[model samples]
Target: MSFVTLSNSRVETTPPVENNSDSGVLSPEPDASMQEYYQLQMDLLILTVILTGVIFVTVCFFYPLKIALNYLLGAVGSVVYLRMLAKDVEKLGRQQQRLSKARLAIFIGLIVVATQWNSLSILPIFLGFLTYKAALILYVLKSVLMPES
Candidate 1:
């Protein structure tokens, strides 16, 4: 081929390569922070399902209590139940502070209960629920009870 013809027919076949990362797009690394966050969220969801299952089992285990208590702790109102649960935890704290040795056993028993209750996950839904109620009581104590006091 003549130099002029060869030069005219020469082609540049290299296509333009666009960088996705440079354009503010995400890469596909599983250990990326976003992926980690998503994984943590999924792990939390699984933990929640597991915790709920354990609570269901615990409740099932306690099912006979309802029948047994038909006469004893009779149909207490919701308000009464809340007060009782709150006072019980408070009394436990007070008794723990006063007689640590005696309360230690109770504390250890609670620890065992918590452990057996949530062996699969260390999540504490039962105590957490009680804490939420305590917090609500505290909020009320601050907002309403304090002003009155």
Candidate 2:
């Protein structure tokens, strides 16, 4: 007998019980909360790329020496900012990681800008940006792909 057998009067049929191992069946869509988180993460990843390019170009037009000094200051600033972010993220969650990652990337960008003044070091610093970009991209991607623990 079917687990979902119907009665005789004005009968309506109900679906069968879903088995856990049914891979052929389409799974349920992500819930609203998960969808929102995914959207937020995707937005951040795109924003990071756009901002990185804008900052790189903007720094180029500004005074090379001043940019170098500012960049150095930014590196120092990141140490302090990261400390605060680390605490906030530990206490709260991924929200603070976004802020922390942005600050860290900015600090790295400053280092790159400084290197531009010394042409010999520019290539190495640019390579560093690639790593920074990858870090941000992965952080954002992971946040989207994985469920929050």
**Candidate of highest lDDT:** 2
Model 2 shows how many backbone clashes?
0
Clashing residue pairs in candidate 1 (N, C-alpha, C atoms within 3 angstroms): none
Tens-place lDDT digits, model 1, residues 1-149 = 00122356795332112224555654334335434434433443344344434544565477553432221211112223334343344334324443224333433444455467533222332343333244345545665866753
Tens digit of per-residue lDDT, candidate 2, span 21-47: 447553345445545544554454455
- Report how far residue 98 has shifted in candidate 1, in Å: 47
The number of the candidate with the highest TM-score is: 2
Alpha-carbon TM-score of each model against the true structure = 0.27, 0.30
RMSD of 1: 26.5
User: Model 2 scores what on Cα lDDT?
Assistant: 0.46
- Cα deviation at 125, candidate 2, in Å, is 4.0
